[model samples]
Target chain A: MTQKTLRKGNEALAEGAIRAGARFFAGYPITPQNEVPEYMAAHMADNGGAFVQAESEVAAINMVYGAAATGTRSMTSSSSPGISLKQEGITYLASADLPCLIVNVMRGGPGLGSISGAQGDYFQATRGGGNGDYHIIVLAPNSVEELGNFPKLGFDLAEKYRMPCMILADGILGQMMESMAFNFDPVDPNKIGKFDWAVDIHKNGRKKSKVFSYKGDNLIADVTERAKRYGLIEKTEARYEARNCEGADVILVAYGLSSRACLEAVSKAEEKGLKVGLFRPITLWPFPSKALKEVSQKAKGILVVEQSLGQLVQDVKLAVGDSVPVGLNAYPAGGQPDGEQILTAAKSLLTGKKEGLFDLQTHAEGFTYECKRDLSLGVQGDRKEVK
Target chain B: MSTILAKKPSTLTDLPMHYCPGCGHGIVHRLLAETFEELNIADRVIGVAPVGCAVFADDYFTCDTVQGAHGRGPAIATGVKRSKPGAIVFSYQGDGDLASIGMAEIVHAAVRSENITVIFINNAIYGMTGGQMAPTTLVGQVATTAPKGRDPKMQGWPINMCEMLSQITGSKYLARVAVDTPQNVLKAKACIKKAFENQVNNVGFSMVEVISQCPTNWHASVEQALEFVRTKMIPQYPLGVFKDEGAK
Candidate 1:
């Protein structure tokens, strides 16, 4: 029997990385994902691993790049804003074809919007946030159990393809506690096989291998090869989950925390004798476009639900095309869409009543930053208040 | 039979270097190659090259090497050293790569006392970008951006990395040297060897800053460049050990 333990999502992911043979972790602190580096700092040494609280997100990602080039399993984690700072290094990692695990336990963003959960990074993760024509394998986990299991899967996929892989979660999933089973055997870094392309000592009389990003005259050829590899990954690794799509009037599309809300809305719609189903994308990058298209063809309409304004709805439109009308219901950043709201939107779409898209710009009246009036006052005010 | 006075170090490959005539990078590369041969660490050493004129350094070094983004070599070196503690790792960077864009990385690596060696080449100008100003460009020195000699009031004073890094408690060794003269080249080699030795002994973070010359960027002859290093650069960045906790 597998051992079961209740753990926070962030802690389980860190432990999962260790069990996957990740021996190097470097990260900077950020909300929703701080527990990852904090847990690694406390336990990594005990597992014969090294952990570093890097000076900045830029340095942390570069550190992971170095370790990964040496054939060591390495990882880094951050929230949305911190992950933005890591884009340069991520692009370099992709260009060099280095394997590593990157986790973005997303928070509200567009510039440090809030410390709460948000799925606003759907486009940033699925489409390339980093420059260049490259794609990272992106995995989305709706539950804590999947969060614990996905890091190992991510590492395996990254190494197998010689590419970086990302685990995209949100503050809700990262902070929530749930009972999860640790079924797989822990990996030993020492027992791992050698990489022919790694930058280790050439004791076997082989030529020293240079792990550099510069392609020189082979730039076109190199990128073409990467694109071919991406095609293979898309064909082999696209994953998704579907519920109650048989004879449904409408299908709801969501992922991560939003998927959980969709499940509840599906049950409520079913209780009212409305034919509604759910389509949750497990891999956001190699997006389950085929699965979504197949299910959307059977439904009368599709409702895309999310925490952010309307990021995932764009992808839904691309996948299903004009076969059926795709509607969107978006809660504000830092707020989750409840079952009632999703049900109402689904019912409205099914009845041919199109609800307007949620506009974050108009709704952000109270959330804007303002300079404190007291700080603008000169020394006439109390010195303590001046600050 | 005549005794051979000198031969090329085995640590250096046959690839022709990309540095301009009289550039200090060539001399520094030679010293590094000689040190690696003398210490018998060439086979196990892994070098991190910066995104500057020396970006092609992997072609010149016989050992395994990785090219890092501009100003990120130290962080990369820290990762390589930590992952494979047995492998000798070093990062080679230039003025703009280290003092300007990479300042935070080097400072934090020193604070963490990462067991790695850093070879910092301070030429006082951005060589690859064709004579642009650098953070280490001496006051009153003219660069492409500072066509009128740099004014401390406008461009800020040149940074002395050896002095600043010495203040960090985790730095086990810090030294500033130049390769303009033959004697100074020997001293620079010795300083580099000691920095690498500190990492091998697991002492702590170590670095050697080499005050170098860039004739092409300076728009000066090779002789004038050497003279400029002695007269102008030395006054601002004195050649000596700034800190050596390992010695104590």
Candidate 2:
């Protein structure tokens, strides 16, 4: 029987991991995601599972690496700075073709920026943060309901692809409370098909299997094989949500927390006789580029709204190409853009009033200009330019 | 009919090791193989190879093995042990890999009392990286980095891992042993066996710090290296059990 309950996003993510047959969880303390480990530490033992509040984020991720190699569904969660520390182990997991779940309940930052909600880690999540020709399957969930469901999806994708799958949630979604349902049957960890290559005692006299990332003399062949797997994943799994995108004048592209605001903005813009629709990417990697390209043919302009300065705008540009103009309405570092703000930006983008707004590359250029312009003046010039 | 006095353990594969001539890793590897065989856990044992000289350890062990990033062997072994508690897991690390870069991992693994065994090879120098200084490098020891004998003022004192780990309550067994002499080699094997036994019993974290000779790194002959272990290394890293919570 399915059960619905009001739950925080971090707690829902942890519960979803448990239901997905993740028998092992190792994580350290971090903001917005602290509830994840706290919940796991309390409930994991009841389900014949193990939980370790690891000494550090590095230890926690490597612990996941170890458990995953044994063919167990294992996981770890952290915020931005902590996720940075886990990159080495994540790369190792990718190299070894070990499956595991990693959740980044992202807080603001290039450093320890803030404890507030931000999608600043889009590049780090979608693109490879670690040193390797590898990509982690990245799933970005906007609501608590999706948070309650995506861990199972993330684990399945990770196991199917033999790579780490990331649940990239921001601080708002992590801390917000919403009603969620557990509709699917919980999987049995033991019954999740045996991995022939796992390190186990039940090999039954066959050659002992090893799990390692070293390519030695076969580096080129090894990387090519990995790239082929990624290609297959892209073909099979590019997920997104398109709302009222057909026959719309403007399409607002966003993900995670920003996507929620964009959805509300779509409705507000429509009510005001302006035609705007929302395109929310559920899987940040294997991005719904094809869908965006199709939607771009119908829409006159694309406005990308995000918590960071302008990370997702680049992807929007790539998806739309030179077919339509793409502008960014970004709330830099920890600030949340409201529905009205997004609606105004969408209208401005449609009217081509891009004087104060930013595009794909100009956002960075704008920041550089602000830095130089501020230094040119003796005093702290203007706060508007900084934002 | 020939009576076999000593034969290679079945746990050891036929592949030739890459250890330099007279390096202590070969002896340590043989000891681990023999221990696995004698304990009757050879087939079920999974080993973690460090990124130092033993990086290719997966080729030598008949049992399943994984290579950990430099200094991450214990963290990796912790994951392996927790996931498959029925399987016997161990990590083999060098001084630079363990006492230096991996200090945090080993310390916390001990604090958590993870039920696994660690075979720490403390040769006092980075062997694979061409004789660089290690955390366990003896005071006044000369290396590429410390050409003028290591100064206590410039570099800190040698880290005593077993003694440091003994203070942690989670560690069930801790020992420091040498493989310099024939009799000492036998003792070192016994120490290693007990450490693995503790893990088999699911006691807690157990570690055997082997005071091994690195002839190439020490820039000496095998005999001179053995003498160095006897005269120099032994005094700083005395051979004995530091802790044994599992002892009767």
Candidate 3:
């Protein structure tokens, strides 16, 4: 049996990157994810890696871009707003066909909502938040073990596809401590073969190499070629974990920390003589849609559980596409759903009660009270009172 | 056979540059190419090209080049150089790139004293974007964005990179030169060589700001552009070694 040691999720992920031969790391301080850069600063240099606490998230991502061009495994991590700052660099990295890891330790947002964990960044992560037609492979880790182990998997997929890979976890997973053992041997990049297109010392009489994203004339052709890879990835890489999904009355769809609640709900639903299934997507971008469609075939209805109000439900709807009734159990703005809460939502799905189950619309409708306008204030600059 | 007095640097490719006539980029590129040949570090040299006029510098120089988004050359160069200490990394930037959008990157790279060389081309206008005001655009100079001719109160003062960077404790060498006259061109090349030599010795951060000419953007003919560089631009950005820790 492998010995497990207690480690914070953020530290585990950082150590995972180091063990996976990520030789370059650049990051800035942001809540929940601050431990990531802290761990890198402490351990990266001793492990023969370069760690930079960049002046900003924008600079950090660009540094990753430069390191990636040299065929070094590079990474940067931040929360929502910081991740937003990195989007420009992320698009450039994808355009230049550079592989690197980007970790988004999600926090409440629309903008600086809170430092507490939230799943509000689902659309941003899966939809390629940057401006351009590109998709980065996104992984959702539910456990501290997966958080510690996902870097190797993320790096492999990124290098194989020659694009960026993101590990999307909320603040809860980042702060929580768990006993997890690394599943892979420590990597030594010195022994790895070099990438031919990498910008490095010209050895063996190789011609000068250029790594650039400015494809002036060949932009369309390059995008079309990249789309083919996206299609292939969609066909090839979609992983999920399913329980009692063969033929259940209701199926619960969730990911990351939210999935853990769904898993517990599934087990409890079994004890209650209700056949509820849980389908948790591990790979969020190549989002296990086909597998989901297969598992949800026999289910009468589907309930999407997530920390956000409706972000994950969008992908869930797209996957099932009205073949079955889809419902949402939402907790927006840094709210976490417990197993009991999820189980009640699952029961509501089975009973066909749309009251508290699909309450997002109801809540929106509840906010329809007329705004009390001050007559004295009038309409801003066009004040009614003659001064 | 006639004895050849001079030839093009080996590292400079035969490809014709797309720079406008009377532009200083051609001269500066040649100077860097010559430095690479002299130092015999062409194979190990990693050149970072920014999003300005010199974006196609990868094609001009026979080196491993990484061209990235605007104003990020220094950060990228730091990444490349730190990953492989044996590699000679140089981030080549224009006024708009280094001074404006990428100000923090350049300042922080200098602050950290990353062992790299910086080749800054200061022409006072955004070249690739076509005659816009740059961070180094002189007060009272007419730019497309500043049609009123760079009012000091409205627009901020032009940045002198060498003099500004000289104050940075981490910077080892900071020189500002020009390629307008034949003598100054030679002097610029020597300054450029010294910057690269500092990197070769792995001492600290070194930057050589070349006061370049942009005829098209300056709305001047070749002769007028060179004259503007010599008279108008040189006075505002005085040529000198602002700081040289090695000399001390």
DockQ of each: 0.76, 0.74, 0.84
lDDT of candidate 1 over A173-254, digit per residue (tens): 9999999976578888888788888999769667888989878799899999999999998888999999998787888899
Interface RMSD, in order shown: 0.8, 1.1, 0.7
Please tell me which model should have the higher TM-score, number 1 or number 2. 2
Task: List, residue by residue over B1-248, the lDDT tens digit for candidate 1.
Answer: 89978888889999889899999998999888988988888888999999999999988999999997999999999999999889999999999999999999999999999999999999999998899999999888999999998998999999999999988999989999999999999999999999988887889999999999999999999999999999999999999999887776
- Highest DockQ, which number? 3
Against the unseen true structure, what C-alpha lDDT does each candidate score?
Answer: 0.88, 0.87, 0.89
lDDT of 2 at A49: 89
The local lDDT score (0 to 100) that residue A126 gets in candidate 1 is 83
In model 2, pairs of residues that clash are none
Task: Give me candidate 2's interface root-mean-square deviation.
Answer: 1.1
DockQ of candidate 2 is: 0.74
lDDT of 3 by residue, B25-85 (tens): 9999999999999888888999999898999988998899999989999999988997888
Greater lDDT among 1 and 3 belongs to: 3
lDDT of 2 by residue, A1-387 (tens): 357899999999899889989999999999979999999999999999889988899989988988888899999999999999999999999999999999999998989999998889999998978998999999999999899899889989999889999999989899999999976789898789889878887456877888887778988998899999999888779999999888889888999988898878887886799888889999999888888898779688888888776678888777878898887777767777778877766766777654334544443456433321111111111223345
After the best TM-score superposition of candidate 3, give how far the Cα of residue A29 lies from its true spot, in angstroms: 0.7
Candidate 2 lDDT over B64-160, as tens digits, reads 8878688888999998998888999999999999988888999999999999999999999998889999999999999999999788999989999
